[model samples]
Target: MATALVTGGAGYVGTHTCVALMEAGWEVAVLDSLENSSSAAIDAVAEVVGRGLRLYVGDCRDNSAVERALTEAGPDAVLHFAGLKSVPDSVADPVRYYRHNLESTSVLLEAMARHGVRRIAFSSSAAVYGLCKELPVSETAATRPANPYGWTKLISEQMISDVVRSDPRWSASLLRYFNPVGAHPSGIIGEDPEGAPANLMPYLLQVAVGRRAELPLYGTDYPTPDGTALRDYIHVMDLAEGHRAALEALVSSAGQVHTYNLGTGRASSVRQVVAALREATGHPLPCREFKRRAGDVAELWADPRKALLELGWSADRTLAEMCRDAWAWQSAHPQGYRR
Candidate 1:
């Protein structure tokens, strides 16, 4: 079995991907700072997979720590998911976002080069395509990131591409994912963002579980059927499977650098998501309409044909399933891994 190292293995996507890798007969190791995540997530993954994963609790920006993880884990490849990811927070502290995201990738790349780990699957974001004019954005679309967070991802992709170009042995799969929501069907592990949730599904779950007073539905004036923003919200399990497919492709394909968008290829509006969550939880969720925030896109989905054709992967979960699974985890753990 191939051994893989996951940088942020305890995070939302990271935990689910770890479960997928383990179930696929891959030996897994995790290196996480536990800053925005918790070690309990790793434990939950162990419970779901019926095995324990090797974990290195350290920041990815630290060269020594990364080197230690590389040396100890001895992974054949790496899945890089360690970075600050929040649009509003990134706007509040652009320097922190850029420095932390860039520095973590730089150090990890350096350690990988030193340790002879050439293959990597990076967690990229759809935010890289800022305010796309097209309905379903493709990989060839122009990348003009609006916020600092998106810029960091774009810059990281460039850095990874540069590395792949410089060396023939190096190969990378940059998986640009759309909105990743929901939880594992088992409800043992899921997205547990620290403090107030930044994404839609988690916030909706919180409101349903009574953690928050009401949902702040941003922007009721977008040019959509519901007069709200539309996004391609893919389930977390589907995204995890995409990671597995990307890792396999990276190991097998001859291409040095590959980019694929992992999404459902269908956009769901905020109103639709709210309605789904309300029905799923059987609660009349209260929502407050607000003006569209800056740097917010009106509509954005994915043309995931490339991923479907090349990676042999596509999101298969519906909006209702996403809400149901997310609520299962939220209702079970109202405090999100704390209780």
Candidate 2:
């Protein structure tokens, strides 16, 4: 088994990816600061693997810390998932967002360069394609990020591209993820957003769990079938599997920077998602229409053909499966790891 270093492996996506890597027989080492995440996430990840994982409590911004972690982990490849990801919060505090998201990556890249870690898989977001004219977005779509958070991710992608191009020895994979929802089938660990949930699934889950009174339906006047915003909601497990496939590609590639869109190549409207959640949870979620969010887009999904064709990766989970798993986790842990 090859050793893989996972930065921010205690995060929602990172924790799931760590478990996926371990399940695939990879020796995983996690470097996390426990800022936005809790150490309990690592425990949940270990529970998924039925054993312990190599975890180091550290931040990605500290070059020395990153250097020590990578050196000690002796990773053949690195997965970068450490960064702040909140659109409204980023809008309120742009500099903080830029500093954390960009600076952390710069530090991680420098550490990887110094430690001779040649391969990397970056966790990017579909937010990079803000207000796209295309329905199902491709990797080559015009990337005009609507919010500061999206811009930071785009800048990070450019940075990775530049670094990889400057050195042929560095092979990188930039995975632009669509909306990631749901949880593991075991319902042990799942999306646990702090404060009010910004994403739809988590917000809806909170409502279903009776934490929130009702779902504030944002923007019910879009040009979609349900006249609400539409997006591609991929299961987190599928996203984890896609990361595994991407890591395989990064290792097998000819030392070139590659980018892929991680999605299910399908779109679901806000109302559609609510309906699916209601069906999955057997709860009629109360929702009220509200004004559109400032940076909300009408419709945004992904054209994941590149991943399917190149990496042999395709999302096998359905929307019903996503809602079911998410509801299961929410029902099991209403407080989300606090209990």
Candidate 3:
């Protein structure tokens, strides 16, 4: 059986990807700090996949902890997802973003080098391609990050590329993600951001579930159809499957750093999202307008043809399904894992 050690596996994407990997017959071990995430997610993953998980509760930046996890898990590859992910938070505190995101990656690479784990699948972001001049951005677009968060992801991608280029034996997949939202269809595991939610989908879920009074609609005067910023939101489950596909490709192949944009090639406005969630929950989903925040672009989606061609992976979920599943999880676990 193939073994994989998932850093931040207790997180939203991490937990869902654990379900995908386990279902695909891979033994999964999780290393998490449980600082911005919860252990309950692991339990939910176990419930969904009908398998127990091996987890190490520690930050990824800790070299000893990572080394120990690597030694015990005996992974074929490492899925690096341990990083602070709030764009606004990163903008407000670039130092924290830089220290945590970069250092964690650096330490994980060092540990991987020590343990001879040559294959790595990095969790990257579309923020790296900031202020995209083109509508459907491809993988080859210029990476000029508008914010510290984007710079971190772009720089990390470069770091991974450099390492892989230095040693041709090292192989890695940098999956540059668009906005990942929604929950698993089982509704057992879903996104539960610590403190205030940053993304539009989570904020909508919170408002519908009474966690918040209303959504704070940012940037209502953009060039998009509805004036709000446009984003390419893919269902989290589809993204999990993409991760599985990427891992399988790595297993069958070798000696190259593969980068692919993981996103649905469709853009949705904030108002459209509000409408979809309203249908999902039968709530008014009130909203208040706010000025555009830093580190945000007017509109951008993905040219997902590369992923579809190479990995044979394309997101097939609709906006309605995304909202329905997300509402299912949030309504069932209103206080998140606390319930």
Q: Which is the leading candidate under TM-score? A: 1
TM-score quality measure for candidate 3: 0.98
List ranges where model 2 is wrong by over 4 Å: none
- Candidate scoring better on lDDT of 1 and 2: 1
Which runs of model 1 end up more than 4 angstroms from their true locations? none
Query: Model 1, 148: alpha-carbon shift in Å?
Result: 0.8
lDDT of all predictions, in order shown?
A: 0.92, 0.90, 0.92
TM-score of each: 0.98, 0.98, 0.98
Tell me the lDDT of candidate 3: 0.92
- Between candidates 1 and 3, the one scoring higher on TM-score is 1
Clash count, candidate 1: 0
Error of 1 at 168 (Å): 0.6
Residue 64, model 2: lDDT of 80
**Residue-wise C-alpha lDDT for candidate 3, range 22-56, written one tens digit per residue:** 99999999999999788889989999999899989
Q: Write model 2 residue lDDT over 86-192, tens digit each, in one string.
A: 99899999999999999999999988888888899999999899889886799889999999999999999999999888898888899999999999998988888
